[model samples]
Target chain A: MHPAPSVIFFSVLSGAGFGLLTLLGFGARATSQGWPAFVFFAVGFVLAVGGLLSATLHLANPKNAIYSFSQWRTSWLSREGISAVAALSLMGLYAALIIFFDIRVAPLGYVAGALCLFTVFTTAMIYTQIKAVPRWHQPLATPALFLSYALTGGALLAGAVAHAGFLFLLTALIQLWHWNGGDKAFRNAGTNMNTATGLKGAVRQFESPHTGDNYLLKEMVYVVGRKHAFKLRIIALLFAALIPSFMMLGEVKHLGALIAVALYFTGTFASRWLFFAEAEHVVGLYYGKR
Target chain B: MTALPETTQTKLGLVIDLDTCVGCHACVVSCKGWNTENYGAPLSDMDPYGQAEGTFLNRVHSYEVVPDLGTAQTVHFPKSCLHCEDAPCVTVCPTGASYKRTEDGIVLVNEDACMGCGLCAWACPYGARELDQAAGVMKKCTLCVDRIYNENLPEEDREPACVRTCPAGARHFGDLGDPDSDVSQLVAERGGIDLMPEQGTKPTNKYLPPRPKDTLDTDIDVLGPLLAPVAEQPKGFLGWLDRALEKL
Candidate 1:
C-alpha cells in the first residue's frame, strides 16, 4: 500500500529465489546422483529464504511479525508467512533426507517442490486478496506470480538438468506469458480507473474533493506521467518477457540458459517495480476530482 | 460464577445509514469536540497555520457508485472503528494494550498498558486505529463509553454526540448484540453491508444500501403544466427610445 520499491523488490526477488530453490531441491532427488543437485538446492534456498527474512527485519516492530502467523484463518499475510516458513522447513528436511539416507529419499524432492509452489501461491494471494487495489485484483495476478516463480526456478533448474533441455525453454515461455498477463492486468486497472472516474468519456469534467492534501493523497494516490509510465512499461515488458524468452530459445543452447536466467531475473525485478507503481488504489478516488 | 448484568451490557456500537446521510460531516465535528475533552490525549495539529495537521476519530469520505443508469450517483461513507468481534488489532498487540471485551465485543486500547508500538494499527484492515502523537497512545472510536453511561446526563441526551447531533438522522446508536435493538432492526430492514467483508473482520457497524433518486417516480410534465408565462416587454423610456431609434 505504501508503494515502497524496497518492499516490492523484497517480495519479487525473494519469490524467484524461493522458486529457484524449490525446483533445485526437486531436481536433486529427480537426478541419479544427488551431490551436485544438493549444492544448487542449498544455495538457491538460502538466497531466497534469507533475503525474505532479512527484508522482514526492517519492519518497525518485528515482534508483532510473529502474530502475523495467527490470522491464517482469514488474512493472506498470515497465510503467506505460514507457507513461507513451512516451505523453508520442508526444503531443509529434504536436504537432511538426502544427506542421511543417500538417494533413497529422493522422492521427497517432489514434496519440497509442492510446498514451494504453495508458498508462492500464498504470496500471490497476499496481493490478490486486497480488494482496494484494483490492479492486484485480477485473476491473472495469482498465476503470473506462480509462473514467474516457475520460470525463475526452472531457469536455475536448467543449469542442473542433465538431459531435459526443453523443460527450461518451456518454463521460460510460461514466464513470458505471465509477464504479458501481468502487463495487461496493469493496463486493465488503468482503464478501469479511467472508466470509474469518468475520464474515459468524450467530455470530462474533473474537480478534486480535498481542499488540501491529506494522508490518503500522500500515501495511496500516486501520479505517474502517462508518457513516462508508457516508456517504463515497454522497458519492463522487453526486459521481463521478450528478451529472456528469445535467449532461452536461441541457437547457443548452453549459453542461452545463462542469458535467459539473467534476463528473466532482471526483467522480473523491473516488472515487480511496475506492479506496485502502476497500481492506482481506489481509495485515491476520495482525493480525485468529482 | 458472577451473573452478567442483563441491563448493563456494554459493547456499544453505531450503525450509519448511507442512504439518509447528507454528508454534512456533523458527526465528524461532534466526535472531535466530545473526544477532545474526554479522551486521554486530544487530537493535535502540529502546524495548523503552515501545514494543517490534526488527528480526528471520525472522517467522512465520499464515493461514487455507478448503477445501470445514465449518471453516476455520489454515496458518502463515514469511516470509524467497527469494534470487530475478531479483532486482529488485539491479537497483534504485544504490550497487551489492545484488548477485546468479552462483555460487549468492543475492542479497546488501555492507554497505560500501551508501549507506543504501532503493530495494532497495521493489523487493522479498516484503518480505524490511529496513533496519538502527543500522548504516544492509540486512539479510536470508543462508542462514546463515557457519555453513554454517565448517570448525570438525562436519558434522552446520554447517547453518543455524533448520533445526537446528526441533523440528517443518519447515525444510530444501540446494542447490536441484542437481536431486538433499534440498530439491529435497521440493519435487518436495510440489508446492510460491511466494508471489505472479505477481510473477515466481522465489523459490527454496517452501511445501509444507497437509495436511487429515480425512486421519486414523478412526472415533469404534470408539475409544469398550465404555468403562466412571464412577460418580456421593455417598460417606460426604454420602450419609447427603442421605437425612436428604429425609426431614425
Candidate 2:
C-alpha cells in the first residue's frame, strides 16, 4: 500500500515500453530499415529496460535478484521476470534482423508480439494474485486496466492516433470502474478487527505492539486524504484520457501526437500512484488501521 | 521450490492463552534477544535512542473487547507466525528463498537467497514477516529451528525462546498435527480458535479465548447488613451524654 515511487515508475514505464514493442513487432513492414525505425525501437528498448532496472532500486538486497527467475512455477513475480526477459530477448532479435539485414521473419515478429503481451499479463498478475489487497485481487481491476493502459499508450507511440484515441477512452472507463469497485473492496472483504484477533465481541485496538513506526505500518498502512485523491483522479482523467482522446480523435497533426504522449504519461503516473496508495492490505485489520 | 509440500511430517506450533497473557511483552523481548544473535542476520534497530524502529518476530497487542452480555475486558494478544499449512508467503517468493519445511512445517526465509523484495511480507495476512533494514533480508519467526533441534542445549530448553520466557505460562509449544498431543487436546477442550479462519490458511497455532468477566450484580449491596448499627439509640455512657445534650 505504500505508493513507492520506484514501483510506480516501473509499472508505468514498462507497460508503455512493452506496448510500443508489441506494435512494432506486429505492424512494422519488412522494408522499414533506417534511422526512424532505429529511433522508434530504441525508445521501446530504453523504456522497457530502464523500467525493469528501476524495479531493482526498491530491493533491499539486489545481489540476490539473479535468483528471482528460479521460482516461475509458483511465483507470479518470478514468472514476470522470466516473461519480461524472454519477451525482450526475442523482440531484440526480431528488431536486429529487420534493422541490419533487412530480413523480416514474419513468424518471429508475431511470436515476439504475443510474448510482449504475455509479459504484461505476468506483470499484472504480480499484483492481481495478492489476495491480501482485495482491491487488486479483482481480475478487472489490475489485469484489465494494466493491459488497456499498455495498448493505448503503445498505439499513441506507434503513431496510430485513431486507434489510440478509442483505446484511451476504453482505458478511462476501466480506470473509473476500478476506482468505483476498489473503494468498497476492503469493507466487503469480510475482514475486521474481530476476525483479525479471533475475539467474539466488539474489539478495539487498545494499544499497538510498538510505540513507533514499523515496517508493516510503513509498507501496508498508507492513508491518502479523500479530498486530495479526488482532485488527482480528475487530473488523471483529463490528461491521461480526455485531453489525449480529443487530440488524437480530431486528427490534429502538428505536434499533436507528441503533446498527447507526454500528457498521457503524466496522467498514467498520477493514477499509478493512486493504485498503490488506495489499496488496503488485510494486515491493516490487525493493526486496526483498515 | 516456492511450491508448498503436499503434507508436512509434523506441525510444530504454539498454543497461546488470551486469558493468561498479562501484556508484559517478556516474550517479545526474549524472542528479539535470542533471534538477533543466533539467526541468519541480527535484527537491527534504525534509531534505538530516538524513534526506536526495529525488527521483531513476535509482538504483544492489547485489545478492548465489549461483549454483548458482559462488561468490557482487556485481552493481551501475543502474535507471531502461525506457520500456516498453506503458507502464501512461501508461494509468493520470487526466489526459492522462502520455504515451508516438510519435515516440521516451519516456514523460513533463506537469507542467502532472499533479494528482500518484501513481497513475502505483503503476502502474509498476519504481518508475520519483517524486512530487516540492516541485513537487507526478510525475517520471521523460525519457531527457533536452531534451538529446537540442537542436541547441545539442555533438553528442557529445547522449546522456543518466547514459550520459555512467558512469565504467565500463557504460551505452549508442541506438535499440533497429532490429535493426542497436549496442545491439540488443549485446543479440543478450550475451543481454541484460529485467527481469520475465513482466509483459509489453516494456521497451525491456536489461541484460547479469554473467560467471561463481570458476572456479579452491581445493584445488590451484599456488605450492608455487616455495616448496619448494633442499636437504634446510643448505649451506656453515650446514651447519658445524649440525654444531657438534649436537656441543654
Candidate 3:
C-alpha cells in the first residue's frame, strides 16, 4: 500500500463525478434538459473520465488495461474497470439525448446512476476485498467510500440544500466510525512474526534480508508517525466532513457549493492518503513493521 | 486462468530446515544465477556496481528466538514463494496474468498478460513477489520451472536451483501432495509447520524449527585441566623435567 498519488486522486475525483451524476439522476424529474443540465453533465464527465484515465498512471502498461476487463468474473479491479465504462457510456448517452433530442428518460438516468454507484462500490472493493490489508478488509470500507462520494457529490450538486446537509452530516459520522473501528481492526487478523516464520517461541529479526531496499520493501512497507496522522485526521475531518456540512447549511448557492466541493476534494484526498498509509498489510509482520 | 482449482493434482513446494541453514546464501545466489537466465524475465540488477540492487527469487534472513531464557542462537530463515492453495494473488489479479498450475500447484505469472499493477505483491504476506521495475512486471520464485521440466536436463538435475545448491541440504523440493514423497516424509518426520497458517493461504511450503541448544554444566570445573597442571608444577628440581616434557 504505497498510496500512489494517481490512485488517491482517481478515487476522490471519480467518486465525486459519480456522486454528482447520481444526484443529477435522482433529480431528473424536477431538473430540465436545458443549459444547466448540460453544464453539470460536462463537468461530471470531465472529472469522471479524467480521473479514470489518471488511474492508469501507475500501470506499467496502460495499453494493456483493456485485458483487465476480461477478468471481471473474479477480480474486483476488473469489475470496477468494466463498470466504470458502462456507467460513463450510459450516462453520456442520457446526457446526449437531453441535449440533442430534448428528452430526459427517467429509467435511463436511474439505471446510469445505479451503475455509477456500483462503480464506486467496486473501486472500494478493490482494496476492501484484500485479506492481506486488514484495515480495508472489513464491512466498513465500502460504506465509508460510498458515503464519502455522497458527501462530496451532494455538495457539488447543491440542488437540494436540506438533503445535502443531512447527507453531509451522516457521511461525516460514518467516516468517523469507519476510521475509529478500522484503527483497531487488523490486530485480530492473527499475523505475527511467530506465524510468519513458523517458529513456536518468540521470534525477532536479528538480521535484515539485505543491506539495500527491494521491491517488496519499497512497495508494501510504509510507516507514518501516529502524531502526524492524528493531526492529518483532524484536518481531513474538518475539510471533508465538518466544513462542507457547515457551508451547505449556511448557503446552498453556487459560491458556497463550489467552496464546499473544493474542500471536500482536499479532505477526501488527505483521508485517502491516510487510508493507504494506515493499512496494515500482513507482509509487515515479516519486517516487524506491525 | 487465474481461477484456482478446487484441488490440485500434486502440491509441489519446498521444505526448509532452520536447524542446519548456516546463512551462507548459497541457495540465494544459486537461484539468482539459474533463474536470471531461464525465467521469462532476467532477474535484472539496477546499478550493479553502484547501489547494486539486484532482484533475486530467494532471500535469507537471520533471527533470534528467546523463551524467557538466558541464551539465544541465530536462525537463518530463507523465504520464497509458498504457492498457496488458495493463492489470492491469482484471484485478485485484474488480468489473468498470475496463476497457479493445477497439475503441480506451481504458481506462475504470464509475463505477456501482466500489467504490473503490483497488487499480487501486496496480497502476498511472505514478501515473495517483487516488481521488476525495468521489465514493468511482477516476479517471484518460479520453482525453477525451466529446469524442472526440461527434457534436456538429466533426471537428477530436475530440481529447484536453491535445493540443489544448498551445501547444508537444508532445502528440499518435491511433490508435497503425495504422502510418500521424500519431501513430504521429511516434513512429517521433522514436524514441519506452514508459514502464517492463520492467514489461511494454505501455503505449500513448510519450515522446520531450530533444535534446542545443549545445556552448559556449571558444576563441573571446565578450566580445571589447564589450570591444574600449572598449579601442580613440580618443585624447582623437577620443574625442569616438567618443562622438558611439555616441550617434548
Best by lDDT: 2
Report the lDDT tens digits of candidate 3 across residue range A86-160.
Answer: 999999898888877878887898999888888888888888778788788787755566656554564456356
Ranking by TM-score: 2, 3, 1
TM-score of each candidate structure, all chains considered together: 0.65, 0.94, 0.92
Report per-candidate DockQ: 0.10, 0.73, 0.57
lDDT of 3: 0.82
- Tens digit per residue, CA lDDT, model 3, B1-248: 57898899799999999999999999999988997777688888888777768677899988888766756667899999999999888899988998899899999998888998888888887888988878888889999988899889998889999998999999999999999999999999988999888777999998987866678667668787776655565868688888888898
Cα deviation of A37, candidate 2, in Å: 1.3
Ranking by lDDT: 2, 3, 1
Write model 1 residue lDDT over B104-221, tens digit each, in one string. Answer: 7666776766655454664565557767656666788887877877898899879988999999999998888787988888889977766555555567787776654554466567
Please state what fraction of the native interface contacts candidate 1 reproduces.
Answer: 0.01
Error of 3 at A248 (Å): 1.6
Per-residue lDDT tens digits for candidate 1, residues A78-119, read 666777788788777776666556543556667777777777
Better of 1 and 2 by DockQ: 2
Candidate 2 on B133-236: residue-level lDDT in tens?
99999999999998999899999899999999998999999999999999999999989999987677889999999865645656657888888868879979
Error of 1 at B193 (Å): 8.3
Best by DockQ: 2
Q: Judge candidate 3 at residue A280 and give its lDDT.
A: 74
Q: TM-score of B chain for each model?
A: 0.82, 0.88, 0.86
Give candidate 1's root-mean-square deviation (CA, Å): 9.4
